[model samples]
Target: MPTQHKNIVLLIADDLGKYMGSYGCPSISTPNLDRLADSGTRFDMAFASTASCSGSRSTIYTGLHTHENGQYGLNWARSHFQTFQYVDSAPKLFNQAGYRSGIIGKVHVGTEEVYCWQVREESGTRDVAWVADRCEAFFQQATVDDKPFFLTVGYIDPHRDISTRGGFGNQERQYGTRVPLLDVKPEDVEIPRWLTDLPETRQELVEYYKAINRTDTGVGLVYEALERQGLLDSTLVMFTSDNGPPFVNSKTTLYDAGIHLPLIVRQPGAKAGIVNPNMISFVDILPTLLDWASIPLDARSSDKDSRLPTSPPRQGRSFLPILQRTDLLPESDWQHHVFGSHTFHEMQNYWPTRILRTRRYKYHRNVAWRLDFPFAGDLYASITFEGIRNVEPPVMMGQRKLKDYIFRPPEELYDLDADPDEVSNLAGEEACESLLLNCRERVTEWQKQTKDLWLYRDGQSVTMLGRYAKDGLQVPERLDFDVENPGTKGVEMTKHLGVDAYSAGIER
Candidate 1:
């Protein structure tokens, strides 16, 4: 590692929450991560743009909201899932800045864009042994070559299959782990009330803990590699997740459990023990890393190029100043609001949704079809079919049920201060007049500014007219549907959610 450029290593786990030993989750053995936390700042108020893998990762890479990045769905090939080649994705910028960049494990960035990188195929967040070895090898090579590397290592343990909940899928295999049984009973796990209380959910939480532990062990390998190469002090390490855990309303919703993620950044030669509570978005990552590495903004920089022509809004400010001095920027100075949306696993044809979050208030705009069409089928079984022959195709087909789950009318809202779970809808509450008004205004402004169909205020007319016209009745200048790739129909469905909502006059 060279002293001129700070080495960057980002470790991201799938579907992790603040349920780690470092964050005061007792019984979970996350020693390696705990050690990292003990030596760096653990952010308590960081958030992902969306809880789903693709949405969150896209937001992190583009330094833009999921809506802005055009990745509201699980798959790519739609206009919304378009890769941010011209934006502030860390890998793109880092590679252009003369740094060797690579990724290991699961990457939600679109397949089209990822072909340029050296990537590993294993997906999920769990105790995969091979991931650690590959990561260590990458670190060693980077060190040997004296390169300031931007390497992203993803872990898929503690996710689905190998779950503790009465075993993963139908195989019923209990996953072994080092974590102890805490006071956390299965009933104590806070999640959507719609899900049934079962042994599976309980064991699933334990499996998640085990997966976290394994991820930490992998982290330790990289840390040891850095130490062996005598580059510990020259590297800046970051640990976080794609989204919230994969239980209940956590992973796919706009509630705190879904979007609020953990972020820990350890810089070289800096204070060892510190905590910064500044509210930051995943989009701010690129600018922060670039600033840390002292990389100047050139023509290739998203910030630099966008300034020349029309500039869409960049939803987050750089964290560099806050990193230098925790008090330099107040939490409010960092953001007025955060936005999120989800259209993945579109049961009833890709449930489209948009959300807004302030410090204490949160609002959701559901632009999907009605929610009562049908409950999704048994797609959860795929987690257990791992390593089985002929399972891949069936698993993939079963996932389509996730896309068939019914959706409901185009609008919803919640005040997180009073309803952290976002269970109650305040969209029609007269008492919340002021909050609703402000939220609607903000969302409309953002939609118009971002050229989304969600700018429409009439939910009824748009839906009726869209249905009548047979070509989505789009709100003028709002989000429109465009199929960028022919094979992926899901992308088109997700992209049309906002347009349909706007056309339906769903806005408050």
Candidate 2:
């Protein structure tokens, strides 16, 4: 019934927030996820690089941010937001190492051959039992062949159904006895601080809770499958979500409600009941898995083409060393800050935002700040949003005004210790000038490293216009173009944040 082969199983949820009991949510108790946390380490400050579904998943697979990986939006036939053709993904690296790699749901990322998953049973089914059955068969096959496996089980629950404003895809189908649908009412839920506590929001939460339960059941079932195969100890399992819950202020935004996620790792023979407080990123997922699989970092890019040799390096290092620790990692041992990149959700949703989030502060640079923030198609159609907009003039989305949510400034800085909800803006304040500048420069350096096209100066992309400097062309050293005094000469150029070139980063 067992082989001691090292294996990896990544469990990804569709659109989930940190709503489990383990994360201190009082609304719904996620017993399965709580049990999972009890058996392993639950990271307190895990983050996704982007908030969009495909974009976030791309970051996890390729260990690069959305801007760096070329999946800056949803991957659809019409949207065409696929990963860059030359990028190396997790499955390819595992498959190349003679490991059987496969994904058993929601293959949303790209051209089929590029991900290179050996068995791709793509589906949108929310049936946890059926999904576990497929995983059980997959494990059985791997056990028979005595080959190590890299499996990704993507769950499609807890995400709002785009077909309607209030449906969570739980109305039409029966998920059987293994997955007991929670009988919830509008009155039974406590609304999140990120959403307005309206009747519409409460009504949607009833349906949302049922889907969350199904996701919890799926996690339990998948783990049970591993137990049945006696591969529990040999396998390293991970559970996380693509982004935050599907709400107006949560899903597609770079706010904490969006990118701040739940990441639990059950490494084999690791200490149980560990609470790891290191700031981890979704970009580190592939590297951690590769490390656990004993695959060298250089083993990737072996398939690099000479014609397309500009493969970006993985922006995250492996967190394998810190995954089993119960104590908080020191700043030197683990980074206390994480960066975020978001460009789009739908094709219409194209507001590019780069973010720098530390333990105390958050900085956001909205490149398309002039444009009114666009909403995702499903989010806009939601009954909760409908209720918010069809109300009084000063409608509130959650605790913040709807107008403030729609119209945003180019830069936003927040002291997270004072405002964890990120409602206050400090970028325009005189007292926060030094802090704002520090955060802005930090994000800018990251954008430069990721080669982000949205890192613009004087309203123009700096990298896109790099070749024009030899022609005596000098752009203004400002964020936006100056129409009043249009003089590029004698005005100092906005140089890098470093005192000199060749330095890694600017210090205070």
Candidate 3:
């Protein structure tokens, strides 16, 4: 394997959905993620900030968004959102650029190990032989310590059929095809009329496509243990998914199947069977893996690692020229506006959503005067094992009242070109009320240039969480919530289940 500093492998597949067969989803068998998207580049507009799962990996290892990365939800310190302190993540900026940063399975991220060299807790989906024997002994201990690495291998198998709302079972579609479930009917199947579609939601999507064909054969056994340690053509194999899927309105809802995912890359100077339709996010994977190992980003690390600290500018922008181009490079200079936020899901209730997606529009701004119930109240109440097997109301008592069919919405605008299943509502479509008021004033000036204007406040203002909770304290249970329901019937059941959870997010 010809050398160079570009050795990195980021593979996540929790709620993965850009439907496989290299993003065309002819129905599942992701032939080694379609040969890693035909050996390189396959984005088709990637997105994810808050579709839950620690607000989409705290906006993909802190490239911001998820309200500046406070992690906006999932007990990452209680979460009012603000991140960068998992010891300055992004594999500690590839371990301060000298590289060597491993993580086996489901490092849900931000519990903290500060850019992991080791955080092996395999079981995001029936341990798959303990993550293929702990990622083949963590790449044979990072190629016998000649470490120029940045490995991440997480798989929670089709996020347990999208957290048990179900559909994607009987495995085998690694690009060979046959996981179908778009307009339901495998026996009255239902679970997203804002929640609750049973027959075990199609037997939990056929055990989530048999855990996505057993995490694509554990990502072809970690790409054959990085091609038997030659580190697969100098690594750089980034496949994705942390949000989107986990049923209902798509993991903690920010829509686009809860944060449109599936972004392939593969490496060896990239550029193989390409297709990079721009609009990437997850905060540009730590300055594109610190600009492919040349590193540098530190800029006095604050404001969650350079969203701004002293000319730190980087909310992500560098697909290295779309990994050598497949065309889609213009959302006015490639930074395709995308932002999302959703603090806590399930129980301690926190619904702070603010998203603005592009590639034909999607804007949702519901600053929680309360109302966003898909799987009812705070969702993802993290008890795991499929949230105690869908909160076992007698092990499946009408999908446990399908959380009384969630309801919530204060604003929503979708037009993914006449709705890419975002099901109508151009925010009161009067010929797109002046393009939804200029996408809500460009999402309130990108939430006041990232200071997140109290998420466009109107209620619950502790004045910027007490001016960033005194020096933006990053972890003490992050944003620690135990209870805070100021009611209005939980804001009218999160807006009467926000348009039937956006028309049961017509899956893919």
Largest TM-score belongs to which candidate?
2
RMSD of 3: 19.8
lDDT per prediction? 0.60, 0.86, 0.60
* RMSD, one per candidate, in order: 9.6, 3.7, 19.8
Give candidate 1 regions above 4 Å deviation. 1-4, 76-88, 112-115, 118-129, 162-197, 296-313, 324-332, 346-349, 372-410, 460-508
Best by lDDT: 2
Can you write out model 3's per-residue Cα lDDT over 1-508, one digit (the tens) per residue?
A: 4244467778888776665667665555668778878878887787877777766775677676655545555643434333534235675555655666777767655555444555455444444555766777876766677667777777766665333233333332332222222333344322333334444455555455556656776777677767876767767888888887566556776777778888887768656888877777777776777776666654323335433223224566656645768776555667766776666654355667687888788887776635645353323432222543555464331222333224545678877787675655568768889998788777765665555534333253322433444453221211112256433333321111111111221111
- What is residue 455's positional error in candidate 2, in angstroms? 1.3
Separately for all candidates shown, the number of backbone clashes (residues 3 or more apart, or on different chains) is: 37, 0, 53
Model 1 TM-score relative to the real fold: 0.74
C-alpha-based local distance difference test score of model 2: 0.86
Q: List model 2 lDDT by residue over 469-499, tens digit each.
A: 6565566667877789778878867653221
Candidate 1 lDDT score at position 9: 84
